[model samples]
Target chain A: MFWSVTQSLLGGLLTTFQIFLFTLLFALPLGLILAFGSMTRFKPLRCLVQVLVWIIRGTPLMLQLIIIFYGPGLWLGHNIWSGNEAGRITATVVAFSINYACYFSVIFRGGIEGVPAGQREAGQVLGMTKSQIFFKVTLLQMVKRVVPPMSNEIITLVKDTSLARIIAAYELTFAGYSFMKSNGLTWPLFYTGVFYLLFVGILTLLFNHIERRLDYFR
Target chain B: MAILEVNDISKNFGSTTVLHKVSFSLEEGSALAIIGSSGSGKTTLLRCLNFLERPDNGSIVVRGETLFDASMPFKEQEKGLRTKRLHFGMVFQSFNLFPQYTALENVTLAEGLLAKEREDYKQNKKTICEQIEKHGRELLDQMGLADRMTHYPHQLSGGQQQRVAIARALALKPDILCFDEPTSALDPELTGEVLKVIRGLAEQRTTMIIVTHEMAFARDVSDKLIFMDDGVIVEQGDPKQVIDHPREERTRQFLTRYAQG
Candidate 1:
């Protein structure tokens, strides 16, 4: 009986992992582009990006998931996401990507701007173009500066994947909660915590390793 | 003909003029040292040559090509100025080596970019890389940093970082090299290491313009020296003549303090 319960949780963990992986793959680069947009000298672009980031960051992720999943269908008189399991998962991923991208953009903008202007000027005097200066001299230092904060957000994201349960997307927590209602097995609901703890523990190790690799800056 | 020429170049930051019609010329292999009190426009003049600080008026001619003309639109001049800057290498007071790059990488990164700009380099990419690597190693070796080639900037001393910066600048083989208070950031003992490398370059007759406070070193190393005060050149001529026999009251007052020290 215990074996079956563990097996079911592991299956749900796969979906959780999928959401986590896809969100990062999309969000990291999207965040960098948004960061550049926010820092542009062009006035309209800079203001538009800042306002968009502000709205996405101000709202709760769970509320965003609900609205993103159901709002389009209700407003347009058609189920844009098709009212299926795939549709529910797609909505969850879209909401997570948009939400995390905004947060990561703030972290990235801070990192990029925090680098000293002298470094960029040095690249300039070396006859490097502006883009070359950014990629060659500034990008590595920016990454080093942003890592600690970025890791905090990433670890939080692992736990927040359980919020996918709000939309009835079958992630790890949703699977565990279902066990409590059907078989009255409260153990699985608590057992889900172990999986989250293990995931976070591994992520902590990974981030620590990254920090060491970037230790040359100091 | 001179290797580099700045004709009546003037720079203004807001309403205040910093460099007022500053005109100077550098011979092919002569070293020119610019001396001045703080905020005397010494550093600003150096920056203007590299186009780091654009001059509001006057023209800059490098190797017979006019890079900047006050009469021209900035958009047209900026595109030309960037390409012209390749002929001049600038060393800063802060030793702005890319912190993430190793000593060798810092020296070679710009070399690779410069090579990419050459149409010939496209057909000979392997040869270009090999040449860059060989020349970069030679420059570091010349700076006495061969063993520390792989070391990052943070691991090096202020002197060592400045020396690496010198090697990086030299890797491009610029027609003229400009130094802006290169030893100001170093300790007294550390300053010697950087000064020694510069002395070697001077001995080899590398064309250089150094803005410095090392009065004795400037007297010994420079062929031509200019003393600047309050946005204008107060005195200029042979380094020893200007240092020993000042013609202007401001230049005499400035040199006496160095003499007393």
Candidate 2:
């Protein structure tokens, strides 16, 4: 009985990990693009991106997941996502990526702007083109500045993955809760906390390693 | 021939004019020092020459080539602006080295990036990079930072950072190098080291335009000096002459204030 329960929770953990990985894969680059959009010199485009980011950030992630997963079926009279486990997971990932991307974009913008203006002026006087200056001078310094805040958001992302259970995506938390629903066993729910702890632990170690690598500068 | 010729460059922010019809010419292989009280537009003048700030009305002619003209269309003036900026190397009051890169990398980063534009960069990539590294090492050695080539900016002293900045500016072998109060940010002891580097460059006949408060150093190093007051040149001639005997009341008052301070 114990082995079977552990095996079941492991399957759920896999789904949780999948959601976490895919959200980052999509959101990291998306966040940088959004950051540039919000910072663009073109006023209209900047305003448009800022407004969109504001809306995404203002709403709750759980509400976004519900709307993305079920709203189309209710409002459009047709479900865009198929009635399957894969479809639910896909909807959950989409909502999570968009939500986290907005948060990350704000962090990225802060990091980029934190670099001293004199640094860019130095690049300009060195004969570097604007793009060259951004990539070589500004971008590297930005990465250093963003790491601490970025690590905070990423850890928060790990815990927020549990929100996917709201869409019936059988993630780790749901797997744990299912034991209480079926067998009237609550110990598995406690067991599921171990998986999240381990995941967050590994992430903490990885971020520490990255911070150490970047410590050569300042 | 004059290496740089500026005619009636003017700049205004909103309604207040920062510089009004500032004009000057720099001879080849000579150093010109600009000294003035704060807000006298000395830094702004240097910025206009390097294209960091646009002049509202004027022309900048370098090597007899018109680089900037107020009469030109905005788009036309912006065209080739980056390459034109290569004519003047700038060293800031703050030694604005890229903190992430090593001292040597800070010196070579620009040259390495510019090297990619060469048509032969692909076939000669290894050799070109080796040459760049060699030149970078030599420059660091010249800056007395041979052992600090691999040290990040945070690991170096202010004087060392400024020397690296000077080396970085010189890597492109600019026709004219501009220093905007290069030692203003350093302590008195550190100031001597940076000044020594500039003194060596001056002795080598490096054409330079310096904006500085080091009146004695300015007199010793610069061939010509300009005293600016209220966004205009108050008096300019030999550095020693301007320092010893000023013709304008504003220049004399400013010099006396600086002396007492």
Q: For each candidate, report its DockQ versus the true two-chain complex.
A: 0.67, 0.86
Q: What TM-score would chain B of candidate 1 score versus the native chain B?
A: 0.96
lDDT of 2 by residue, B1-261 (tens): 899999999999889898999889999999999999999999999999999999999999999999999999999899998899999999999989999999999999999999999999999999999999999999999989999999999999999999999999999999999999999999988999999999999999999999999999999999999999888988989999899988888889999999999
Chain A TM-score across all models, in listed order: 0.96, 0.96
Name the runs in model 1 displaced over 4 angstroms. B117-123, B258-261
TM-score of 2: 0.98
Task: Residues A1-218, candidate 2: write the lDDT tens digits.
Answer: 78888999999998888899999999999999999999999999899989989899888899999999999999999999988888988898899899988999999999989999999999998889989999999997899899999999999998898898888998899999999999999899889999889999999999999889988886
Tell me what TM-score chain B of candidate 2 gets against the true chain B.
0.99
DockQ of 1: 0.67
For TM-score, the strongest prediction is 2
| Candidate 1 per-residue C-alpha lDDT over A88-197 given as tens digits, one digit per residue, 9 for 90 to 100 | 87888889999999999999999999998889888988888889998888998999999999999999999889999998888999888889999998999889999999
- Residue A172: error of model 1 in Å? 1.4
Question: Each model's C-alpha lDDT?
Answer: 0.91, 0.93
Error of 2 at A180 (Å): 0.6
